[model samples]
Target: MFPLGDTHGGRIPPLNQILQTVQQNTDSLKTYISAHHEIAYRSIQQHNAQLAMFAEAAKLQSRGLEQFLVSQEKANLHIREIVGLDLKALAREKQAELGKEEMEKREPMLRNYVHALADFVEVVGGRETQSQNGELNVAASVATIKKAEVKPRVWRRG
Candidate 1:
């Protein structure tokens, strides 16, 4: 025989060594999985935090826009009120100017009318004294007075 036991037979590892190696590999795998889980968890948390920040920013932007619109509406209403008041004041000023112009124009015509009426009265009285047509002349004078007393019609646009 070459040897009593086979050569290199005792070089094989024991069962405890194999079991320890498998346990070490399992522990390493668990550690790797735990590290990956931590990384994924942190990523999810960061994403959620970013989403929350964006949502808050959007809310703030919406509120700011609403406030801006409200302020603009208020400004526009104020401007309209100012414009309305300005228009009213301008209308009143124009009305006063037109009244002054109408008065200035009517004054001279009224004076001329008074002078003509005086001359007509003097002539009519003289004619009445010199003629026997007194009744017709008085009737004509009364008719003229009636015509002068009538009010002039004024037309206005609605």
Candidate 2:
């Protein structure tokens, strides 16, 4: 394709608010809203699709909020110590940002979120199964996994 013009169609056409263009934009917006409503506004039932969707959104939003903290803490923050989970600094920062009155009002909801987030992270990432001491936790007789290769003797006995 020559830079001059592979085809005149590729060249920028004059911007116009034609009916077809308007209809396309409307269709796309409706689709987007429909999808969001399906994931976020559905009635809770025997299955928790809405909760799962909100949980995933929370993880993404948490990372985004991390960028806005006035002073980001380098140390890991624990949202709940009993879980022994290390969460992003923003988790602690956001909880602290709530006023004393608001915190009291939201205590139960916050507790439930902390517990759910820990369990979700553990299940999805499989991190909980690994021992905190850097060893695999299993009931098998096998002791340790030997990932490193056994090198050949430097001076072989011929």
Candidate 3:
């Protein structure tokens, strides 16, 4: 027969190779855990950083919305003042001088002021979901006020 004893292999030195293989497996497991832990820590840090950025952005957006509301209030006040002046002019033109006709003519404007003032108060009163339309609704309010008739008062014509 052929040489069968030391031909292909001679048991292949099993002891030392087995020990080295076990050590390599252990090392690989340790390295994997370390790498995984590092990745997890980095991911947590990144998420926390993004959360902070989003919070800051939300704060800035809220501030901008507040500024816009303030500007709208100012504009409404200006319009109301102008409307008041117009009422005064109308009184002057009629030569009523605070008489019945003048009062009647000014009544609608007064009502408009009341409504606008109420709306402004409601919006600025810090209630939830305050009016977002702002000064845009003032014209509609004015029109509504104007439609109400002013009752004529009896005058003594001094």
Candidate 4:
């Protein structure tokens, strides 16, 4: 009953059906690959846009900080000049007060007034209030009032 050398009986697959199945699978794979490529391209574009925005914001912040530092330096210089002028005015006032009649009788009162004013300035101006040991350095402040004078012991308290 053997015809030639073929071992298959009669269940051989049709060539047309096999080819069609292969074509359908290939088409499905192509569609999926195209969609994936489009999505990847769009994601890259969005990321690039976000990166550009971040870079611009950082540049603006750097500029703002530079401006602030410049203004702060100018303000500090102005404050020092103002304080110098105030000290000179206070010295003039003290001289006038001491020149009055019977100066010796009111010397104590005038000294107290000057000390009070100095302490007020130190507090209001937010200057350092403590000495080397955390105690109030009233004399140190008074010494600054008379910059030319060299009598340190006379002004020191305690």
Candidate 5:
């Protein structure tokens, strides 16, 4: 009257064999997790490196802009000096004028002054004469000339 289920042979698989199988599976899983973790870490490192590089580039751009502004200031000063000298010369010539012959001689000087003033305006103001739609604006050129007269002198030797 032995138990029917355990009648023939009550032998189970060896404990050592079961444990070996479990260890092999665990090692495989460990290898997979380690590999995944390594990949994720490398990806994060690369992303951080890219962000650092971008930040450095932005800093360089800002420095470049600062340098450009300083250069523009210097150029404005030079332009002012040249324009002042030209205007003074024109005034002196006009003051010394006697008749129509003097006026005739001064005409070319006046034209030169006008051209120089226009150039100065274009350099100082951020206005562009060329339209995006390709239409020329004659009024813009006149406005630029008037604008030059009102611009503060960058060079005033005190």
Candidate 6:
């Protein structure tokens, strides 16, 4: 290779050679710095994109939760409407009316039930305490005698 400039007594390079080396180093440093800057910029943009996606997901979740809460509140209001605002006051207001209505509705059914229960008891009591013309009534099993003696055998473990 042909030398661009000779070093004086091999102690110091020429001024032009020194300047060229410095310029090359400076150019490499600039290139390296620019490459790193581009990488960092791209990384920041990707992070922002990901953050935006996450934010949108969070917003959707928040909206869904809000809708759920609204529905729950509506359901509570509907139940309150069905049940009334003050149950104690309502019960107090309806006590006499409900009692009279319930008694009127159940009186005939209760009477029939009592009559049926009395008839059932009478039939059951008559069957349980049966008498045949003032004579004693006995079960056939109790009246029959066992001519053959029954002996229960005990099993022994061998």
Top of the candidates by lDDT: 3
Q: Please, what are the lDDT tens digits per residue for candidate 4 over residues 27-128?
A: 999999999999999999999999999999999999998986666555544443433445545544655655544444444544655556455555535543
* Between candidates 4 and 5, the TM-score winner: 5
Which regions of candidate 1 deviate over 4 angstroms? 1-13, 83-89, 95-158
Which residue runs does candidate 5 get wrong by more than 4 Å? 1-12, 77-89, 92-100, 105-158
44-74 per-residue lDDT for model 3 (tens digits): 9999999999999999999999998897667
Q: What value of lDDT does candidate 1 attain over all alpha carbons?
A: 0.52
In order, what is each prediction's RMSD in angstroms?
Answer: 27.5, 29.6, 9.4, 10.1, 10.4, 26.5
TM-scores, each model vs. reference: 0.48, 0.23, 0.45, 0.51, 0.52, 0.49
Model 1: lDDT of residue 45: 100
lDDT, candidate 6, 1-158, per-residue tens:
22444545545666787889889999999999999999999999999999999999999999999997776655544433322333233323443444655535544533443334334333433332323211121212112211111111111110
Instruction: Write candidate 5's Cα lDDT for 1-158 as tens digits.
Output: 22334534665546686688789999999999999999999999999999999999999999998997776666555444433344344433444543455545544534554556545544544433232221122334344434433222221221
Candidate 3 regions with alpha-carbon error over 4 angstroms: 1-19, 86-91, 94-158
Return the candidate ranking by lDDT, descending: 3, 4, 5, 1, 6, 2
User: CA lDDT of each candidate?
Assistant: 0.52, 0.42, 0.56, 0.54, 0.53, 0.47
- Clashes per prediction? 0, 0, 0, 0, 0, 0
lDDT of 4: 0.54
* Model 2: lDDT of residue 66: 79
Order of candidates by TM-score, top first?
Answer: 5, 4, 6, 1, 3, 2
Tens-digit lDDT track for model 2 on 1-158?
22335534567433463455777889999999999888765554424876788899999898787763422221112111322433434344444666455645655544454444434444534433223222122211012111111111111111
For residue 156, model 1's alpha carbon misses the true position, in angstroms, by: 22
Per-residue error for 121 in candidate 4, Å, reads: 6.2
On lDDT, who's better, 3 or 5?
3
Q: Top TM-score: which candidate number?
A: 5
